[model samples]
Target: MKSELEKREILLESGTNEVEIIEFYLGGQSFGINVHKLREIVPYEPEAMTSLPESGPSMKGMLLLRGKTVPLVDLGSHLRKRQVENSVERKVVLVCEFNREVNSFLVDGVNQIHRISWKDVKPLDDFFTPYKPRFTGCITVDGREVMIVDLEHVITEIFPEQTIFGEGEVEGAEEADAFKRGSRQEVKILVAEDSNIIRNQIVSILKSSGYEQVTSFVNGEECWNGLNMLKAEAAHKGQDLREYADLLISDIEMPSMDGLTLCKKIKTDPVMKELTVIMFSSLINEQLAHKCQEVGADGHISKPQIHALVKMLDEYCLK
Candidate 1:
C-alpha cells in the first residue's frame, strides 16, 4: 500500500482544474474514471465472491476486503458488451471510493494514466438525455477516445433510492415542504449542473420549497458567463448583482469549466465575492471537500440529501 504522504503527493494542488484519469479496458473499449475516485487495482479472485440472491445481473457479487464489504460490478455486463468473455483475458479489479462508498469494478486490463484539463472533456450531446447514459464525459487521449464512466449513475442504478436529488423524502422533508407551502421565499439562486436529470430535479425541489427566483446553466462556463452578463447588466445600469442573484450552487464536474475554477473565480471577485457559494455533487469526499474549501466554497453538500440540503438552505438562505 502507498503511504499516506505518498498518496497526498500524488494529488494535484487545488483549483488547477485538471484531472488525473486512470484509463482501463473493458470489452476491448477504453474507459476511465478520475484517479481520486480510484482506491487501488487488485488481482481478481473468482473464489472470493459471495453471490447475492436478489441482486441484479450486472452485480457479480460481494467481496470482503480488509474488514469492509465491497460490492463487485462487472464492467462488461453493466455496459451490455461481452467481447472479452470468450477471449483469453487477465481481469483486474479497480477498487474505488466515491460519494463516501467503496466498490470494486472488474475490467479486462489497465493502461497508463493520463493528465488532462477538465475543459478538454467534452459533454455528450442532448440525444443521450432521454436515456441514462452512464458516462460523465469523453476525452481524446492520444487520438483514442476514452469514455469516462459515470460511476455515480452506475451506483444509483443499482440502488434506485439514492438518486441525485432523488426518491422519497428524507424525514424532515415533509415538514419542510409544509413550511414552504405556508410562506414565500424570495431567495435568488444560480445553479450549474451537467446532468439533465439531476438539474431538473434540483430546480423542481427549489420551486417546491417556495423559491421562485431560480436560474440554471448546463455547466460552469455557462454559469460564469451568466454571472458576467448579470455583472455587465448591473454595470451598465449602475445596479448590483445583489438585486439579481444571492447565491450559487455548482457541481464539481462539467465540460467547459469545473466547479473549483468557478468557486475560485467567484471568491476572488471584489463584488461577486459577497454571494454565498455552495458546492454540491455526487462525488463529494474528504479529499475533494478539502479542495473545495481551498477554493473558498462557503459550504459543500453531497447529492440526494434533501433534508440536509434544506437545512443548509435554512441556515444560509432562509434564516
Candidate 2:
C-alpha cells in the first residue's frame, strides 16, 4: 500500500501550492485522487458485503466499516470499463470522505502517493469518454501519466439527491436583501471554482438568493489575472480593489493555481490585501481549516454547505 514516497513522513506547508495524489488502478488503467479525501484503505472482502436488490449497476453493496454503513461503489463499472467486476484483479476498497459524507470506492489496486505541485497538474477533458464528470485532470508521475479523478463528481453521480441547493438557505437572508436593495443593485462577487457542475451550482444558489453580480473563473490563476486587470483600472481612479468587488469565493483544488496560494498572493499584495477571500472547498475539515487561516482567508466553508455560505455572504457582503 505504501511506496517509497509514502514511506517517509510527509509535511506539506500551507500556501506552498503543492498536493499529494494517491494513485490507484482500475481495469488496468491508473487513476489519481487527492490524498486528503482518503479516510482509510482496506482490502476488499466479498464475503463481508451484503448484496442489496435493485442496486444500481455501479453499486456493489453496502459495508458496515467501523460501525458506519457506507455504500461501496464500483469505480470500474461506473467508468464503463470491461472485465472489471469479473476480472482477476487485486480488489481494494478506498474509504473516502468529502463534502461531509463517507463512501467507499472499489478499485483493482492502489499504487503510491505522489507529491506534486498544482501547477504541474494539467486540466484534462476527453470528448471520447462519456464519464467527463469523473475526469478532473491529468498529472505525470514517474514518466507515466495518470488521470486525476474528481471524487466529488463521482459521489454526486452515485447520490444525486445530495446535489440540490434547496431554497431554505435563502429564507432568512431577506433582511440583508432589503439593505442591499436600498444601498445597491447586487453584490459583485468573484468566484474561482474549477468544476463546472459545482461552479454553476454556487452561481445558481447566489442568483437565487438575489446576489446576481457574480463573475466566475475556472481556476485561481484566471481569477488572479482578472483581479489584476480590475486592480489596474481601480488604481487609475485612485481606488482599491474592494470598491469594485465585494468578495472572492475560491476552491482549494484547481489546475494552474490553488485557493491557498491565490489567497496568500492577494493578502500579501498591498493593492488587493483589503479584499475579502472566503475558501469554499471540500477539503475544509477541522485539520485543514488552519491552512485557510495561514493563507489569510477571512472565512472557510465546507462543500455542500450552501446555507452556511449564504449566511456568510449576508454577514460579510450585504451587511
Candidate 3:
C-alpha cells in the first residue's frame, strides 16, 4: 500500500484537488500567497503605528495589534525597490508564523483570491544580482503578473541577530530511537541542495525519518546526471527505477542549472517521470510552487518548521 505521504504526493502530481490562495498587488502586478501563510488582510491606517528606529529604510513601522506590537514591513520596498507611497488602497498582510514568528507585510493594495492550479506557478530567477528581500517567486493571476513573497527569507533578513537553527546536530545518537521505530524499509531520497549546512540538515532530518539511503548532490545538473546514471544502472541490473529512488527533494536556487530546470528535465524524461519530486526551498512563494507544478513536481514545501517536515514526509511518503 502507498504510504499516506505517497498518496498525497500522488494526488498532487496527478492533479487531483483544490488548493488555498491569497491575492495581492505589487509594482502594478497581481500576485498571490499560499493560504497556508496568509493569516488575514487588514486595512492600512497610517495613524495606527509606531516606527522602529534603525530598522532600515524598508521597515515602514510597527502596529499595535490587540495590545502587542508587530512590525509591518514594506513589501514593495524590500522586493522590487518600490515604496509603499501613502495611499488609501494599501493594506497590511498578516503572514502567519514564518520562521515560527508572526509577521505582517505592507502592500500597495489587496486583490481578490485566485483559485489557481498547483501547476500554473513558476519561480523567477533572482536576476537581481545580490537578491532582494520579499522576492520568492511569481505567477499570473487574472491575466496580471504578481510576485510571491518569501516570508521566511524576509523574517530572517529582518532579524539577523537571532539564531533560528535550533539545537543543531546532524545524525546524532539522539535520533536513533526515532529512526528505529518510525522508519520504513530503507528508502532512497535524491537530495539536491546548494548549501552544505542546509544540505546536511536536510540529510539528518531524512535519516531520522528512516530513509536509510540518500544521495546528496550540490546542484541540479549533478542531480540530473546522478538520476540518469541510477536509472541506467537499474535497467542493467533489471531492477525497478522506482526502487532506486522513492523521491527527489531539492532546493530552488543553485549554482549551475536551477531546480526548475532539473524538475523539467526529470518530468519530461519518460525514464524518470514517475519519480516523486518535492521542492524544499527557503524561498517561499506561490510562483515557484506553480513552476514546480508546470515542470511536473510532486509537491512544494517551505523550510519554515523543520520539524514539521517529518510530518510532511510521513503524510506524503510513508503513510
Candidate 4:
C-alpha cells in the first residue's frame, strides 16, 4: 500500500496552494505536520528504542527500523508539557524526512488527515514571541485550531552542528562576499518565510554574506503586496520592476498564499515574470522541484543550504 505521504503527493497537483496535514495530539494539545514530510507512522515500542547516554531530555533515543537507525524525539517533552498518563498505550512515532535527513517524533496519538487551502493557515508570529520554536502556523479544523510544528527548527535545536550557516559549512564565502561588496549592493532580494526564526536567520545570513538590500515578509501575501508596491514605484519612475528587485527567495509552505502560488502569480504577470524566482524551502524534493519548474521558477534550493544560496546569488544576481 502506498504511504499516506506518497498518496497525498500524488493527489495534490502542483500550484494548487493546498496541503494535507496529519493531525496529532501531544499533551492534550492538537498539532499538525505536512503530510509530505511524513515517511510513515508506527506504533511506539519501548523495546524498539535504545536509550542513549547523555542524551537531551527530549531525545528519547534511537529506533532501529529496516536496518536504519533513526533518532526519536519526544514531542511532549520538547513542548515542556506533561503527556496524558495513557499516552504510551496510544503512542505512535511519526517518521519524517526533510533536508535529506530522517527522524521520528513520538506523539500521544494520531488523528485524521485534513486537506485545506494554504490561505486558511495563519502565521503565528504575530501573536507569539519571536523565540518560540515549536509552532510555525495555526489552522482551524473542525472548529478547533491546530498548531503546525516547525519540525526543521526542532531538529536544528537538537543538532546545532547541522545548521547550514555554521562555521566551515559555507563554501566560497569570501567569493560571495566579494561579489556582494564589489557590484551587488543595489541588487534587491525579497524573502518570504512564515517562521520568524527561519526568516530572521535567513535575513541575517544574507546580510552577513554582504547582500544588504534584502527585504523580508512573513508570508506570501505580504510578499505579493510588497512586490506590487515596488511595481507601482517602478512604473511611476518609468523603470522596470527589476530595477527595484532582482530576485525573490520564498518558502514553499506559508500562510495566506503559498510559495508556488506566489511564483505562479509572478510568472503569469507580464512585468513580474522578469524577476528571478527561487524556491528556498525545506519541502524541496523531486516532486516539489518539478512543481517549481512548472511555475517558471528560475531555480529551487533546499532549506539550510546557506552556502549554496549565497553561491547562487553570486553566480546569478551578481553576474
On lDDT, the candidate that comes out on top is 4
Q: Compare candidates 2 and 4 on lDDT and give the better one.
A: 4
Candidate 3 lDDT tens digits, 1-319: 1143223333433222234346776666565665546545667778878888878876888877778778888777776545435543455555454443567788777655554543455556658435533444566765666666556666667676533345543333245475543554466678998656568867876666566687899777789889989999999999989878978888765545567678888888888988888888755565446767787887887764555555555556664
Candidate with best TM-score: 4
lDDT of 1: 0.80
Each model's lDDT: 0.80, 0.83, 0.65, 0.84
lDDT of residue 212 for candidate 1: 59
- The predicted structure with the larger TM-score, 1 or 4, is 4
* Candidate 2 ranges with C-alpha deviation above 4 Å: 1-10, 84-89, 125-129, 172-177, 180-186
Provide the global lDDT of candidate 2 against the true structure. 0.83
- TM-score for candidate 3: 0.56
Q: What is the C-alpha lDDT profile of model 1 across 22-109, one tens digit per residue?
A: 8988888899988777778788888778889998989999977777679999877888867755653568888987766788988888
Clashing pairs in 4: none
Clashes of each: 0, 0, 10, 0
Expressed as tens digits, the lDDT of each residue in 238-300 for candidate 2 is: 986777898999999998899999999999998899888999998887757888998899999
Model 4 per-residue lDDT tens digits across residues 107-204? 99888889999988876655576545667688998888899998988888888877645765556545555545756566799999887777888888
Candidates, ranked, TM-score:
4, 2, 1, 3
